[model samples]
Target: MFCYQCEQTDRSDNLLLGCHSVKGNCGKDDRTATLQDVLIVICEAIGQYAVLLREKGVVDPTWAHRASYWVFTTLTNVNFNATVFQRMIADAIVLRDELKARYEAACTEAGETPVVPEGAAQFVPDPGMAGLLKQAPLVRVDANIDVLGADVVGVRNLNLYGLKGLCAYAHHAHALGHRTDETDAGIEKALAFLGDPPTDLDSLLGHALELGSLNLKVMEMLDAANTGVYGTPVPTQVRVTPVEGKAILVSGHDLGDLAAILEATKDTGITVWTHGEMLPAHGYPGLNKYEHLAGNYGSAWQNQHAEFAAFPGPIVMTSNCLIEPQPSYRSRIFTMGPVGWPGVRHLEHKDLGLLVKAAQALPGFATTDPERSITVGFGHDSVLANADAIVEAVKAGDISRFLVIGGCDGAKPGRNYYTEIAEKSGDDTILLTMGCNKFRINGHDYGTVAGLPRLLDIGQCNDSFTAVKIALALADAFDCGVNDLPLSMFVSWFEQKAAAVLLTLLALDIKNIRLGPTLPAFLTPAVVDVLVDKFALKPLGDPTEDLANAMAGA
Candidate 1:
């Protein structure tokens, strides 16, 4: 029951260096936690066959998407029901076994022997809860720590967690009807590497970097998937306040599901509001065209307990960042995709009519709240549209620098650093933000620069691609390397998705990035030393001091 895959992981400097208690920070019990590791073991096995079958060009992309989805369910704040995981275990085994059979046949046709993975890689879960619990110890995340030192374990887990986050993005892109063989094979290749479990730190760390490169392709597909459906994001101001009517709050980063919900509720009198990462949906022309798509309702995922409870209508979690649903609203709140809680109702295949019913039954927004708004939809295309102005502003020194200071936000201590950095930036600097980290200081006025808003909201965490594209365009416009541009990155990571983003930055050879509030609990001082030495990565210090140093080109 040990885990440290998210920012809110226990860091008491204990033996496990993670949540070894009955309940984790996201309210995941030990039973569910161990079962998640077991599921991952199955994924590694699937990947082992998937990689080979892919080479033979016989693997099904649906299975790869399934494997990626299984990884997404294991992410922090996603699924918490042990019973649901039990069924998933059985289904994953069927999937894994199907791949195993194909791999054997392919080898037979090629007249070559297929080497099968052993131990957890090919583990068969024993029947009943007792048998499952008994098998859990063999596949725990730290199972290799005793044989291979902590350093090797740390690097291996880094690669594993990076794959988890990268797969989540892949799942998102696939949901939007986007899939690529190259990325699918890469995901399987990563799983196959983890199946063998490397004992060397260098091999593990190097693979982590390769994962970063792979994530770029996944992000590009996701960017295409979104723009292809939504007709490219335009700068649109979204109301941050509530309006009068029956309401339904849709959270997470699934635009496809959100569109379905909108279609289902077109005339039901339920006004839909985007929450958490879904706030960026307003900027999309396709979504904005819906007359009942009201506005944003809450801040970030961490505040869901209070916000969801106080809300007037039923809530729908489209994908992730779900916490324990309170008794107050548990009955009305519904889980979609991989999100599940023991008692919370689950929506199947974006069948949002259930939410339409729940919202109509409840009182929604007693009256329209005061008007307030925030700007979003600064996708690469939107930003690049004003490329001429931005390049000229940079050359004229009107816009001194760009700061990317956002990632997944958490409920842990020290996150105020983001708020401080944003507020402390000089008028000459432009603030670019993504993920829930923007909720920390986005509501504050930072004023405009270079004939545009100083703080540009770049949609969700996946939109980190947009930020990178903007930087690259700037570099090309100025005829310099991306690293040579007057830019600085400060990443605030809470979960594995953020890990994938950080790895992408590192793969690009981008250096001098700062990370905090604390290093990942899974990483040892040895792993940190390697990052510090190679990438000039540093732990964040005083925000004001760091901002000043960044401005001075330090």
Candidate 2:
């Protein structure tokens, strides 16, 4: 199979042969490869439209949303259906031709080679036919370097993956009636860079960081869109035990779907419980006010197989990570947005009749357990509102340090480090978390500091924007730079969004972050050195040792 969705490949060529000898690696077959090809074509087409819109000073919400969704769907492990992808490609090409014609006419009137959309697709010349176009090229610069061995590929993977997250967030914002010209332009520019010819390892590394920078802007736009529409998150205590009798458990990261579910279920005698990243929805002013909005059920995505199996009612996944649904819970598992698993019901539109019917048919959720409550919210707004109290706590030595330990939670057992670190952290320390990864420490009884819960679940992964906001606010309140604040980021990364957030932190000049469980396969020594020297980035070590270093450094 031919593949080149990332920057790193063998023989200075963008394409690579599938390692047929190795099973489960890449999990790609010929069909998947073709689908990826189609996806690249669609991205190019979308890029072309995006560039046109940018130049025309007119933004099309539908085009922007569709484009972003296309990019996100191409992310690794997201969508593998060749038929669906090909249809999307067909749609994209149709749109591309229409936009190209419009652009060409406008340009002819003004006199110039119409600016080929920022991320426009290029036809590759076939080696066999001299100049004849063979097929469309993948959306990655041909960084044919062996400089850092597999590290180059790793960096490439990181960049592409981060773009996927950026696209996903941008798509979500578009859905919410929020639009930013700068974000739209950034997507076009970044996609164009990804599809450019390969440069040096250092240059690619810079692009990786740039992806993070752009993601920050995208995430900020999403943060504003979410908070503006839903109100700033406040500290909330959500119950873990299902409310006895009929209920629905909603997972994944789509707030819009969650809101819609709440609305549809209103006065239906069905209690709504949250799972995974959806747990933090409990903090939102509008969501929290739901009388039937019970509490969170599971911790993170990885534990869903068992947790979901044990769940008492129908479960809906708005956008799950690595969806490996067990047959036991498969019928109860409903997918929405881009998330899908064969045989699982997918609710893509606002219609929740199926969910309602399923909830009504099922035995319904169990009663809320008084002993099982998980506190949520603690987002940027809540944290900043309590900035004075936090400052006072710090001044009084009640809080000596703050650690941000949150990112993608994977099934790998090594992730236990996060829980261990949280459990062992000093009583005077504050743990700020986001994403499903917070489940690692969510169950820990770290108590509180100055009426503030020690562990703060700041919402979904995109809420990393809130983490940055809190850091900046704290720094400002303390009359010092962010690096000077008693704050440490020990992030766990498993996908592109994590890469983007890491880059944002580096861009902000936040130093000495400990990243792990394993460093990205990307990041050549030279590139890593630049990060180390410039930002003091370090790989995570033993929890005990890292904690000591963190406290000592603070």
Maximum-lDDT candidate = 1
Model 1 pairs whose backbones collide: 7-494
User: What is the per-residue lDDT of model 1 for residues 177-231, given as tens digits with 9 covering 90 to 100?
Assistant: 9999889889988988888876888888889999999999999999999999888
Residues 285-372 of candidate 2: C-alpha lDDT, one tens digit per residue:
8777778887777777767778888887899877636355778878877888776544566686666988998889888754545566
**Residue 538 local lDDT, model 2:** 89
Q: What is the lDDT of candidate 2?
A: 0.72
In angstroms, give how far residue 229 of model 1 lies from its true place.
1.0
lDDT of 1: 0.88
Q: How close is candidate 2 to the true structure, as a TM-score?
A: 0.88
